[model samples]
Target: MPTKRDLLDLQFMDARCKLIDLAAFLDRIERHEGEPDFRLAAFREALPILLSEKPNRARAVLEALSDQTPEPIEAATIQGAFGAPQV
Candidate 1:
């Protein structure tokens, strides 16, 4: 059985993947002119999903951002600000 920590980690990873997909979609929008309006609207709809109330999702995004070779310290700072797990 997966421990609570493991479950949390997995949830975090899933959320991060969703965020990465959102970023790629945004990049596509930025790179292309005459993109459909619906595309932009869809991207906007996904924004809240990527930044949902779930802490694991946020943590996952932060983890992936921190893993970049350049290491975005801002992500780490945000994660740290959330503090440790509650009892």
Candidate 2:
């Protein structure tokens, strides 16, 4: 069985992956503005990370962006697309 620290680390990694997925979902939403289902699905994926005991920093950035007027999607360009980071 994994130690507590290992489990926490795995949870953190999962949260990071969820953030990446949220970014992709956001990109898709930007491309197709009419899909509320897609946006809801993305929000569902992101909800865990947002409500986590230790919130993911990247997700926090996106959440802050989502709150502003005109939306960050319209204001600033996202630098990275979804994929596992290079080793």
Candidate 3:
């Protein structure tokens, strides 16, 4: 049986691989000079930072919840949380 940490690691690797593949595919395509694809561009830049910090960051988050308090949130109260709906 895989532990929570083990599953998190697998999911993270899967996500990272998908993102990198997307970036590579996009790079292979011909785009107009300096056309702003801000979303993908930002993702490409952020992926490296995310990958670099992943291990320590994931450990820190998981460590904050002790053995007794296994679940991060007992229950979530979504009432009055989100404000305006995005268009």
Candidate 4:
């Protein structure tokens, strides 16, 4: 059960980090709080799969988006994405 990080031969780092990236994006945008409801919904749905053991990250993301529902998110642990400074 290798984590995505172990697959160094493959080049899809951004894809691997979609859930995390989305989460941070959601957190950053919460202050404005005017994002489309579906974006929030997608984030809510995707969170569970993010924690699961899945060989295929794309599949988890797809499943999460396939049936997203509205849910409120409490504060997320925000961090700099991909080690780049926040704007």
Candidate 5:
């Protein structure tokens, strides 16, 4: 089993790069003039989960962005997912 230190040594750079990429994405979003986007809102809502000392942060974040309608829509709108609830 890998110790915490070993995990950090192996993954820290990759994690750091992703964090930087996310920050850059946020920067681009901030520079844009756009209407409110539910997907972006959901993404922001999930950010706090990363800071929490929870074992299931990935599951929590995925759930936060998921559509929880519990039933299928009668028809397809775009034949693809919006990546977050359309709310």
Candidate 6:
């Protein structure tokens, strides 16, 4: 297994790029004049998980954004997913 430093050396740039991209995405969202929706709300809620000392942030974040409904809906509203729950 790679050491912490070795892993950072290999992944730092890609991680930095993703961080910057996320910041840019938030910037664009802020610049728009519209009401915030579930997707934005979910994304904001997941942000703190990234900073927490969690062993599995990815799974936590995925669950945070996922629909937790135990039962199926009567019908589909759209052909594709909204990327966030409609709640």
All candidates' lDDT scores?
Answer: 0.56, 0.58, 0.53, 0.59, 0.93, 0.92
Best by lDDT: 5
Q: Candidate 3: minimum summed lDDT over ten consecutive residues — where?
A: 61-70
Off by over 4 Å in 2: 1-3, 35-87
Candidate 4: segments with Cα more than 4 A from true spot: 1-20, 67-87
Q: What is the C-alpha lDDT profile of model 6 across 1-87, one tens digit per residue?
A: 999999999999999999999999999999999799989998998899999997999999998888999999999978988777778
Residue 32 CA displacement from its true place in model 6, Å: 1.0
Q: Each model's RMSD to truth, in Å?
A: 14.2, 13.2, 11.6, 12.9, 0.9, 0.8
Looking at model 1, residue 25 earns an lDDT score of 73
Quality of model 2 by C-alpha lDDT:
0.58
Per residue, candidate 1 scores C-alpha lDDT tens digits across 9-46 of 87988968976986897788788878455434533544
Model 3 ranges off by over 4 Å = 1-20, 28-34, 55-87
| Predicted structure 6: clash tally | 0
**Taking the tens digit of each residue's C-alpha lDDT, what string does model 2 give over 1-87?**
999999888798887897798689767767885645443554555456655677475766466335333434554355763322111
Report the lDDT tens digits of candidate 4 across residue range 1-84. Answer: 767677654657766687478768867877684545554566566677767786887677775555333553475466422221
RMSD in angstroms, candidate 1? 14.2
- Ranking 3 against 5 by lDDT, winner: 5
Clash totals for all candidate models:
0, 0, 0, 0, 0, 0
TM-score attained by model 5 = 0.94
Q: State model 6's lDDT.
A: 0.92
Q: Residue 59 of candidate 5: its Cα lDDT?
A: 95
* TM-score per candidate, chains pooled: 0.41, 0.33, 0.30, 0.43, 0.94, 0.94
